[model samples]
Target chain A: MSEPLLSVRNLTMRFGGLTAVDDVSFDADQGAITAVIGPNGAGKTTLFNCLTGFYRPSSGALHLQAAGHVHRLERMQGHRIARRARVARTFQNIRLFPGMTALENLLIAQHNDLMRASGFTFLGIFGWPGYRRAEAAAVEKARYWLARMGMEERGDDLAGQLPYGAQRRLEIARAMCTEPVLLCLDEPAAGLNPRESAELNQILLLIRREHGCGILLIEHDMSVVMGISDRVVVLEYGRKIAEGTPAEVSRDPNVIRAYLGEEESAA
Target chain B: MTVPAMLRDAGLAALVALALALPVVGIRTVDTGAVLGLDYRFGWVAIAVGIVFGGRLTALLLYDRLPRGPRRIRTKGLAGRSRTLVRYAAVAFIVFAAALPQLPFSDRYVVDTATQVLIYVMLGWGLNVVVGLAGLLDLGYVAFYAVGAYSYALLAKNFGLSFWECLPLAGAFAAFFGILLGFPVLRLRGDYLAIVTLGFGEMIRILLINWTTLTGGPNGLTSIPRPDFFGLAFTRSPAAGETAFHEFFGLAFSTQHRITFLYYLILILALVTGWAVERMRRLPVGRAWEALREDEIACQSLGINRTTTKLTAFAIGASFGGFAGSFFATRQGFISPESFTFIESATILAIVVLGGMGSQVGVVLAATVLVLLPEVFRDLAHYRMMVFGLAMVLIMVWRPTGFVTQRTPTVRLSDFTPDPGAAR
Candidate 1:
């Protein structure tokens, strides 16, 4: 009943004649998982892009309220949406800095905070005590996240060489290092096996419970969606055809028809 | 393997040998007393063909006989060992370079050549920041170098500024130019970025050539003040109210004193640049650069300001180029636009890339090889470039990633662990 953390109003994104995300509207509450599920080309990823400021929507308003401040996502730049709005994201394809160690990847996620603490490298260069303290704190924070992701022992290993499942977890850990009010994950479980998916589900649940940050997930895997998501929004042909609890959305005839085309259902 | 496969490989080898030998053996010109005659060095060609054929057959046989798994494991082990070896080699090289001028056999030519090598080393380190750490291909890095040289030349000549006074000013000017170039080409990537930067370098050069009133056109500025030892000039006689450096030290005035002094100056400057770059690599901004290099979109999504990150890399990198440029101007006592040609940029860039993009030790090693090799092969004359080109090709073929490809992670949660696989 309380106001949601993020509110989207009539978000529409069109490319030439094709409408990718057609007037989509949704609300994601704090400390809850909202899963957007649809078949291929259903614009779930497109919606995430618009919300994250990667794409300027043709017409839309995204209002994010955090710490008694409101950010107009549509007006902010991509980096501002992440830094000022405290929104973090992970790509569908893992985007870890391949040459960097696992620890450095997490540290980079805290770049802005560290840059400020170091007086943009001037104070740090002179070994200012305050800057040193901040740097140590950053290392500690990075260590805690690495331990949480169960990659503490692999902190020195190059990120690209980590096993696929571990890389996925490191990506999440990196995003969490930014201490975002909202975390957006696109297909975090795409290539993950069932066990990895189960681990991912538990990690997301723990993040929500402990960190109290809202999660926006776009997942093609139904098990991950149905298992942990508090609410599900299903899209078909870029339109929000169904939205409800997992069981309700599963039973909805429209959702069923969208998954299994009408021709197959009729046959 | 099968007999037919062996026969086919033998046939291919024969064909390759024939093709290789035809040019050297079939087309030959010989001189006779009266006119010209055609002659062939078939013996030499036959020997070359035999070596190639034998080497290929032996390699094929060995490859077939050896197990692949153990070879891979051995290479991985070697990769780990080589990293430590490289570290030791770098330390030894530094020690050698520091002691070169002090050595009994070090003469003026040796000291002078070593100083030139240090300049390229500094330039290589500067370009490494943009091309290697930041992953911005900068084909026009010489523009910043030129800016630094001209800034120092103009300042010292017109305003009568000391070399020491003009050093930082030149760096600032170069950094300004870096940001100027960075702003317009911020959106370009890869080859497009390369072309734009290449054009930017040419623009600076062409402007320097045409702007006659300020730059003295192609004639350039001359008699720029050489760096003094504080207020003391390294000359035979003392100026008004000041003693010459050698007299102040109670040592006889030898021209070698100034040459040696200049050598040490460049060495110190180069070491400072290297130290600063190494320190910055550990700082937040440097890590941001590496991250941006890996994935620009990911960097933006993680709240990193891409524009600022890139501009900072350019500015800082250019400033070092500026410092080196000013030193070059003071060293030569002159400046000309010809020194800031595209080939200068290419050579510095080659040093960075050939040394292994982000490795400081690699840059030093590469600069030494590039600068010293030609001087060492001075007798080879026209053949030196051919030899240099061949060596580069061999290096690229043998170790495509570079001589020192392993990257030490900036931040580590635990004690450093050498990951052999991280070399890539």
Candidate 2:
């Protein structure tokens, strides 16, 4: 009933003669999980890239209303989309700073806020009281995320050394440190074991409930999609084929056809 | 060990020995005043070949006989012990450096060599900020050094500014040049970035040569004022209305005093640079640089402005280079484009790389080795470079990451209380 936090209208991305994301539109509300599901090359990633300002849409309007401000994400640069529009993302492949410790990775995610507190390193260099306080606060925030991700003990260890599951959680924790109004996760559950996937679902649920940030997830795993997503948007051939509740989308003929193929659909 | 394997190794060593001996031993000519004659040192070659054969056989036998698991465990233990030993060695080195001038046998030559070492140490540390911490692969670092030197030279010559006055101004000018160079190469990465920076360095050098009026051209500026001890010149005799440093201190007016004074000045500057870089490592900007080094896309996703982050790294790194350059000009009492060359950049880079990128102590150790090794082998003349190259190759083979591979993280979550209440 309340206004959706992010409204995407007629978003399209073209590469040469091919359309990667074609006229796809969706509304993701705050305090909810929105899953975008598609097979390989179904343009799910392109759509995510468009939303996060990694790619400029051929034609679209992305309106993100956060903290009583509406941001035109299409007009913003990639970094501006993250900093100004309050959009944070985790890559399909975990892109943690491998050499940096898990804690440093999280702290760096809070760079803009800390940079502001440090007066762009001028205050920080001198170890001003204000910068010290902010730094302490940042460490505290990083510690909290590390603890929540069950990585408190491994906080001092390099991110690359962490187990795959922990790295995935750390990536999400890093994005969370930016305090994004909208969190976009690309295949966070990919390569995760069943137990890790269940844990991820719980974490996402907890984030939606407590943090109250809207989550946009792209997942190939149907169990993850059906288990937690409040709404499902099925994309096929770079176009939205179905949009409804998980159960409704699962029952949709187009969605079934997309997943099972024409021969299996006929059977 | 298999007999066949041992024989194969010996055969390989024999081949190597033959190749080595063929040029110098087999094909040798001698002149005995009146006549030129071909001579054979086959006996010497045979002895060398025999030694190589024996060495390879012994190595293979020893390697085969060693217990693998215990050897690995012993090495692991040794690694841990060596890390602590290295720390203690570093402290010992610093103490020795600090007490060198006060030592009984430290002459002007020793002091001057030490000063040169310190300058390279400072340059290595500065370039480390860009290449090591920021992972920018800057191949034109000497350009900043030139900028600083020229700035000080021109400022002191035309404006009559003191060394102290021109020092910071030179640093600032170099930082400006750093930004100027950084702007065009922001989008470049790795090898491409290296080529552009190399071109930029040469461009600056060429400009210095051609721009005869400003930089004194190829001749360079001369008689640049030396940095004084708060208006106390380290001169043979006091200038009008001023006492010489040695005279003011009631010490003998020896040239060693000035050399010692220069050494201490550089030591202080180098220490300050080290201190600043260490502090900046824990700062947000520094962390951002490291972050960008690790992953650029991730950095952008986290809202770090890549351009600003990179520019700051360049500016800060170049500023230190500038400081070292001005000190160099002051020390030499002259400036020339020749001093700032691709070789200097390569040498500085070698120090940083050999030291281990992002390791401060590593830079000091590397700078010492790189600067002093050549001087120590000055008698070897033509052979020194070959030895130097061999040493570098050996080091790379032994530890490609650097002499110091481990890096201390800038921030640790364990340092803070993991309080959920505080987190809120």
Candidate 3:
């Protein structure tokens, strides 16, 4: 009944007159898992980019109202978007600082906090009680999150050396360290096994329930999407074809056509 | 890991303190040896001090303290820029002589070489700023050096100003030229940046060779004034009424006084350089360089302005080179484009790279090896260039990251969970 947490109104991104995301709109409500699903080149990633401020949309608007504030996601750039509006995201490809340790990767996500300390100087690089406390708290928070993900033992391990699956897990943990309000994930299940996917499902559920944050996921896994997503938006060729609960959208003719090619002209 | 490392560090520190102090009590004079038809004096103290100095320093290449918890840095100030201020003050006190010199014996000409070594130490530290901290590989850092030397030569020769007056002017001029050089290479990356800088150095050298009116062409600017004490010019004595710079205490001045003054001047410069660089590394721009070195895209995402960051690196680095350049001119009392050759640039860069990119101690060692080693092998000075180049290649092959790489100081570990979405 309350207003949606995130509202994308007629968002369009054009590259040389080719509308990559054309007149697409959707809302992700508070504490709900919203799935954006489509085939390859369906503009799912493009839409995600627009939301995260990586790509400035050519026209229309993308707004996030969360944490007692509203943000024009399309207008903000990368770092400000993460810090100011509490927007966090994972890339389609892992983007961890490879040379840094597992703990450092997470700590960097709390860069704003560590920087705030400035030795002890609150406003500068002088000794101050405030910075020390902030730094300690940031470290504590980083440790707590790493431990929660079962990565506490491997905190000193190099981030790049972690196996593929743990690297994926570490990426998620790093993003969480930012304490984001709206978490956007692109193709989280792309290379995951059933077991990993199941673990991922539980993680998403925990985020929604415990963290009280809305999640926008672009996924191709049908079972996971249908089982977990409270609402689904289907896009094909940069245009939205259906918006409904997973069951409703699964049965929609347009959605079916986008996936299976018109059912071979069911004459 | 904790107990063993602490014990090892304690032992090493104790050993280092004793070894460094032994020379103070034992060696009061230099030893002389005549070999291969040349006058030679090799002090065991010099080589012993060199080893202990190198030993105490190379330890960093082996162990870096990564922050694990809240105790790595002691901060009693506010939580922002105040931390930066206090850090700078601490570093300054340790590096500079609060706001400020040394000894010389041996062959008369050896002092010039020693003085030159001191000058290169300052220059090495300066280049370390750009190549080490900023992760900007410069093959032509000598271009700034050239700018400074020529700035002094042109200004002092034409205007007849004292060497001290030309010092600040040379630095400002070189800094201006640094911005000029930095502008075009802003978009360049890696080898391209190296190539552009290499070309820039060549350009400066060729200009010095051909710019007859200002730089004196092949003849070079002659009679550049040596660094002098006010009203004193390294004289052995002065009249009772007139105070000689070295005779302030009424003692008969010796050649040792001039060498000591020059040694002390370069030492002060080197200390100032090391301190300034360490201070800058802890500032906002300092952190910006580290971030940009690690990931440029992430740096931009963090709202760091890239252009200013790059320019600051260039300007600061060039300023130091200029200070050294003016000092070089004053020390040698001659200015020629040949002195600022491509080899000079290569040698300087070699010092920075061999020292371990951003490590101050590393740069000093590299400079000592590169500058003093050949002098030690004056018998093979003819083949010194060949040996130097070969050593550089071998070292790079041994440690591709350089002798000591810049490490972000992290000191402790903690438990933290990452965003599960981060996997995507």
Global lDDT of model 1 = 0.89
Q: Best TM-score goes to which candidate?
A: 2
Candidate 3: tens digits of C-alpha lDDT, residues A124-162: 344355755565566666677766677777776667778
Candidate 2 residues lying further than 4 Å off, grouped into runs, are A264-267, B1-58, B61-64, B68-94
- In order, the B-chain TM-scores come to 0.83, 0.86, 0.69
Residue B415 deviation, candidate 1, in Å? 4.8
- lDDT tens digits by residue: candidate 1, B1-424: 7656875786688778788777855667778888888887778777767777777777777778877574331223454466578769868877988899899999999999999999999999999899999999999999999999999989998999998889999999999999999999999999999999999999999999999999999998888888899888988877788889998899988999899999999999998999889888989999999998999998988999999999999999999999999999999988899899999999999999889989998899889889987887879876588678768898898878777787866766664333333321
**Which 10 residues in a row give candidate 1 chain B its minimum summed lDDT?**
B415-424
Using lDDT, rank the candidates from best to worst: 2, 1, 3
TM-score of candidate 2 against the unseen true structure: 0.93
Could you give the interface RMSD of each candidate, to one decimal? Answer: 7.1, 1.0, 6.6
TM-score of 3: 0.72
**Model 1 chain A weakest 10-residue run by lDDT:** A258-267
Model 2 scores what on Cα lDDT?
0.90
Per-residue error at A195 for model 1, in Å? 1.6
lDDT of 3 by residue, B1-424 (tens): 4646655765576566456545543344444455333323335545555565556445543454544565443322242454465468547744543222222235556656656766777888888777876778888889899888888877877888887788889999888988998999988879999999999999999988998977889899898766567757676655566567666756666766766677668777878787777755654446556656766655544334567778878888999999998887776778788798888888888788787777776776678678877777678745575566667688788777665553544424632234344322
Residue-wise lDDT of candidate 2 within A15-101, one digit each (tens)?
999999899899999889999998889999999888888899999899999988899998999899999998999999999999988
lDDT of 1 by residue, A1-267 (tens): 488999988989999999999988989999999999999999998998998889999998999999888899999998998899999999999999988889999899999999998899898877788877777777777777877888789887889989999999999999999999999999999999999999999999999999999999999889999999999999888989999999999999999889886755456
